[model samples]
Target: MKKDKEKVLDEVWTEDRVREFLASEPKAGTDADFHALLKAYQSMRADDFELFIGMFLETNRNLNATDKAGRTVLSYAKEHRNSGEHVAALEAKGAL
Candidate 1:
């Protein structure tokens, strides 16, 4: 039972799940979208974040999205600890 619970907790976020959440919004280039991406970046592992970002971009989501304070997802990834991989992924995607 404990192992089952742990497995559930360890369930990975799929591209479909990411799309479903983003699709809830009317548009893609909103501050809300940026914030959501920021939150996901902060919470997800480096590899998972890369996958999420890839899926996000695949759906035509904004890669250069910025928050109200004018912070881009690239900025957030750069500042995050152990996010070197994430930053590199974002850069490859042209996240400036």
Candidate 2:
């Protein structure tokens, strides 16, 4: 079926904008619940992820937590090949 480009974009743009609007929710602090933590993790870019992990690890938290998808923060570092602070955070998190 031929699709109308404008119609598709209009439909998609609302959700996209909403997602973007809702993306950068600020956590109160280190006690982010598991769901919030997962969303925060999923929403992060590589550098942001590293920074967050560093924050957590600085307070002695482990970043190697498995999500509902059975993926860990280590999984993201491995997937992105990010061999920097993110990796360090994961290591600090006890993520092998």
Candidate 3:
């Protein structure tokens, strides 16, 4: 489970809050699209992440974007046993 120092259960996720993630940029050589997707996956719960994906797609972002290591967000989620919902969200979006 993700352990946050001050985790807020049942926290509200407004559209603006979720949309803010889209503005995230990566380091010089990192893929910007991939970075945004990865950040959202790491920061959001599966449901919110799914909502973020819809907004991401509306902006024409690449769902299959890979990191320098050639690992997509789905790859990272797959490595975690607790990521069933997250994996389902990625697959629903047709991520490779």
Report the error of model 1 at residue 59, Å.
1.4
- Candidate 2, residues 1-96: lDDT per residue as tens digits? 876664332232332333342234444542232333355455554455545554555555445545456666566656765446556655765666
Backbone clash count, each prediction separately: 0, 0, 0
User: Between candidates 1 and 2, which one is better according to TM-score?
Assistant: 1
Q: Which number leads on lDDT?
A: 3
TM-scores of all candidate predictions against the true structure: 0.68, 0.38, 0.90
Off by over 4 Å in 2: 1-37, 67-71, 76-94
Question: Higher-lDDT candidate among 1 and 3?
Answer: 3
Clashing pairs in 1: none
Please give the CA lDDT of all the candidate structures. Answer: 0.72, 0.49, 0.93
Question: Is candidate 1 or 2 superior in lDDT?
Answer: 1
Q: Indicate which candidate wins on TM-score.
A: 3
True-vs-predicted CA distance for residue 81, candidate 3, Å: 1.1
